[model samples]
Target: MTNTPQPVPASQPIPDSTAAMKSAVKWGVMGLIALAVVGALLAGLFAGKEGVYGALIGAAVGGGFILFTALGVLLTAKLPALTAGAVLLGTWLLKMILAMVVLFVLSDMDFYNKTALVLVIIMSLVVVLGAETYGVLGTKTPYVDPTPSSNVDDDE
Candidate 1:
């Protein structure tokens, strides 16, 4: 019955900055993995022998970039969860568009590489579905409040 406000833990907020960043990093990592697999397949199927090495390098570099960018976006307190989600989602959509463009362009040239195209297509599907899955699961993660006497305690 006391109107006294209790200290709340930092985790329960929907716009939790930390969770937002963590989710960003996680989704980004997953996307990078899908891309890496596709890239490796592309190299093995199209780039000849040296392409394998190049593909590995590409995977590492690409994954690193995504990870860092995601981390950066999430690390800042100024960015909200919606913003983080938008950035990550936007990047993924843009990449898919670019891949489609490449596929169409290459197909026009009569130089269609089935392996590469299929890899891209599959990767895109996985990324989209995985993102959705993460979206559902990410929100389910429990946020713990450090302060037990916070307003949140009243709700419980």
Candidate 2:
């Protein structure tokens, strides 16, 4: 038997990112929540009630931003590429505005520890983003072939 090169065929539709996004969202959420618990505990230990409050708020804001982005992509997966892109962009802008408003409002409040809040928020972002990346990279996808349809007899 001789081995010959097979002619490549036309490309196919791009694979949907829903599965990957789902994986990302699921793991990212778990990681963020885990961080929230740990951060809250540590902060509470160090600074008391104010620390606890700060940790919770910070975790929500930092992790929530990225999680919402994943959700936006997952939700818009069925739409046309351009449409989905537009929707995601809009969602991102909205999230940014809301985050700014929330932070601005929180700035004046003296109920929470600012240092704890900032640290936990930054940590939450790093942990959740790492988890999301792991989920996406670890996902299993079916192989894609660009070869023409099979020419062998089915019943041979």
State which candidate has the highest TM-score: 2
Of candidate 1, the 10-residue stretch with the lowest lDDT total is 108-117
Model 1 misplaced regions, further than 4 Å: 1-15, 76-156
lDDT of 2 by residue, 1-156 (tens): 544455544574444547788899999999999999999999999999999999999999999998989899889989999999999999999999989999999999999999889999899889999999998998765455545458845554
Global lDDT of each candidate = 0.55, 0.89
Candidate 1: tens digits of C-alpha lDDT, residues 77-150: 46777886777777667666764565465454433334444544455445544653475466644456434543
Clashes of 1: 4
Output the lDDT of residue 37, model 1: 72
